[model samples]
Target: MNSAQLKIHLLCRGIQLDSSVDLDADARPILRTRGGLASGIEGILPGGLSINIPVYESFAADSPFSLVKKEEKYYVFRDEEELSEIVLPPNPKFYSKKTSSGKLMSRIGVMQGTYLGIYPTDICEFWKTDPPSNCRFCSVGLNLGSTEDIDKTDADLLETTLAAMQEEKITFVHFNAGYLGGKELEILEHYIELIKKNTPLMVGLQAAPSADYSIYERLKKKGVDHLSFCIELFDEERLKEVCPGKSRTIGRKQYLDTIEACSKIFMRGRVSGEIIAGLEPAEKTIEAIDYFAKMGVVSTVCIFRPLIGTQYENLPSPKPEDMIPIFQHLYRTTLYNRIPLGMAPNIKVSIVMLAEEGRGLIEKKGFRLRLCEMRNSFIKFFISLYFKIRIRYGKIRLGL
Candidate 1:
């Protein structure tokens, strides 16, 4: 294969391999391939490549990697190959600690691997009325059903989140609750209030769009460092089909409008939207990313991974090769525009690299000076154009 075809093949291979195991030995090849390196390429690199892998890996684990528990051992496998095996992270010290009110800390919330995740409420009116209204990619109902308790109070969540931060050295806190239908705004406010009263750490919240701007202002005041209101799709018709619940509840135009309003309020870098790559037309996603970039909202493009018990379980996921160009373009645009790094706190290294290159242009003299200035001013614009042409000719490539 030529370099272009080779690049595509490598990306495809990266996407095809599932790397959800905890051990580095099992995940390295998938990481190398995703980074556009030869599968066996050995070396250390810079920047925040490790962070992006988790979101995609989370999706991959649900679809491809199967976890089996036999007797005392937990094993992760892909088909017949036993990739890696290990015991789960020890329950944190805080799990055994409880609030003065007597709620179990673990039941309120817990640290999963590296993330501080909380499901304060497991009931969504959307799920109750019509399951299809839910995002096609989400397994919220399945997760809720498998777990015993249905609701966790705001006070309990606050206590647990605070304990995790203080005792576990946790840096980020992520919380998502079930959609409350007519009570969406009110319940969200309760969560924001509780989190603010309890912790000073960076916090993220995900919920269906709300009708009131005041609630958003309250959340911002409550110390919400980042916000993700996922549209899930750029195409209107696709939204109707893939997220019927969200579409009917929030409406397509309202969702986009809310994102626009959020960009204005949260300002660039603090605001973000999620786009499921495999579900929508690639061109539509490109358009959406560019549109969001101009609006100062970071677009997080995640590959579609069919969840085990979801409605789409029997459907196939988009091949990794097809997702490479899109991911590359998205990352390049994000870097060039200086989008705030959101959850990936480690992305500062890459931003510093781009900033230094921009500064280098300003220091050059004569024709070089003018050329560098032009490059510096339109870094994102140029990168977008470059990727557009490269992808059109099937030459797009990424080095992680």
Candidate 2:
């Protein structure tokens, strides 16, 4: 297989064999068995490509690939043949330190590619409710009392963020929390302001869409550069079944409206709706991508891997081949709508497919792919001109 194709295959299939850990290597402790299974080895390849693949436990031992270390260098091998030289992302210097509140810096925030991911809240409120509502595929609810700490103060977050920026050169911060209410937004706003005021890093926040539209404005004012709502399903019935709390509270229309409204406020390419690839049918997933793309919202696809502790733990992961068409559809739709892939540079992370990889696959096979690239170029140029004019003249007030 070609290199791009092989990497995509491995990402979807997951690495089979594992690598030994060296605590003395001065790398970030690879977190295993956490909320999203965000802990794993960061694999760097040719063409500046990188991915955060799971190497913990079964994910390492059950897949078709392996990451082996020899002579202090990491390489990815498939069926005993080396594909490319790789590097495990370095552990941030701040991770070894402690926040002012005595919280371990690593506990406060974890690195996801170029972005520092901070989960401010440990558990989803829906899971805490008597009826106990949560996304069936989510592991956050399962991790609440065990792996995650419930109380992470704003001060702890700020101190950790500052250290990450200074030591790791991370320019982006993604603030995530479970299904908390306005209180979560308030907390996020406070942290956003603190980080914006103190450092040059841009910040992003992902949470349930609030019923109040004004909260979006407040968030933008707080200097949140990008915003996201994790509406994991697109099919009406499936959404209700998969995300009971969201369905019962806001309903599908409100969720869609919230995303559209956020896009209006955040502008095209700045807002995203996260949808898992495996939970629903491929057609519905493609439809969601089209729907979001038309609204100028980027679709962040999280390939469904059944984390061990979640409700769907027994469900098999979608085959790597199954994702090819889904990703192709996403790439074509986003290009048609002129929305850029990925949040920013150096920010490729595990949960979503990198836009570059998708574009590479599309470009490698010319035909309609060539047409898509031409259209993408035209759309990109016009969009760039629009933004430049908007900024240069300051003709309109964005309140940002």
Candidate 3:
């Protein structure tokens, strides 16, 4: 399909999609369209869209493209027929087991779509005060405050994680913790060590930079496959305004320094930095991506989605058109450097599709325009979802 046609198809599909209750506003609609539950696109295509299911075994009986029903039947929909199917991954016998502390092992960590996401600590230090010092994009602290007994001790986390590995065939395990008072990074190290000691699964850790090199050494010893020091933004002035607590705790240079140090330890193609798109000027984002690429770090460009209770709630998301070019540039740079798209699986999936279609053709100096169409599709899906939910829910208040 032509780039223009592909962009239009993606936007239309994204807008008409439906979702399950648990999916975030944006993902729900996209899931619906993907599942063939939503309407439109009857005549435009030659025999409907093709869905490729990633092969992995899990207790969950549903295919990636289909949803499981309450009646214990798998539902698969196509343009002409819907089929009742049975697709099963060997049930991890360990899933039925509990931790020594009597916590349900399954509840300790969750599989969000495809990724195994675990929260070591649900509380952030910044949330303890008025006008909390947490990052503007985070809702972890607020969510933790609303719930009782949110903390997952290091032992329990490790035990449950081990059980998950034994029971579920997880491809990657992602560990994210709330900002601990002063020991956030330290606590993360403990969990990392335990996981390293126990399993050989791919591990990705996200946290602010630590105070010392020893922590990095400890992490390396524990077998961290990927590391993300989320600097979040590149504009120094904007960094101060948006993430004052982070700015004070770890300055931009220090954050960059940490990534450099980690890159040295982890080596190129293994270290990454996170940059939230739509938060700073296009130039700033471009500069950060180029800088990270030069330093052998993959720049994970996340679209700035304002969480329900964060400070930037009223702000509008950057239009997809605005972010498409930026994504294309970064994707092409990484491709040129032979950097495997690190830990950001979803973005990699989309970009790979674009690359496969020979969209990496247009060039303005060093930047390419081929991936923009696909990038814009992702952006449109997210923005449309963001606005729809905001309008319906009217500022979601996490019961903090």
Best candidate (score: TM-score): 2
Which is the leading candidate under lDDT? 2
The runs of at least 3 residues in candidate 2 whose Cα sits more than 4 Å from the true structure, single-residue gaps closed, are: 18-27, 32-37, 57-60, 363-400
Candidates ranked by lDDT, best first? 2, 1, 3
- Candidate 1 stretches with Cα past 4 Å from truth are 1-106, 110-113, 130-132, 342-400
Across 320-380, the per-residue lDDT of candidate 3 in tens digits comes to 5666677666767665655543223222222112222223323453333335344545655
lDDT of each: 0.54, 0.71, 0.53
lDDT of 1 by residue, 1-400 (tens): 2222222222232223334433333222211111011122111122111111222432343444344444545444456665444243344677667766786666566453344666666566666773246666566665553432356666677667767765665555666665676565566667776665545445677677776777788788877767777788899999999878778778878778888888888967677777777788799888888888888887766556554456765566566556655655565565566663333321221101111222221222466444534554465455445534533332112111
**lDDT for position 178 in model 3:** 52
Order candidates by TM-score, high to low: 2, 1, 3
1 or 3, greater by lDDT:
1
Q: Write the per-residue lDDT of candidate 2 for residues 342-372, one digit (tens) a residue.
A: 4343566654575546765664565765676
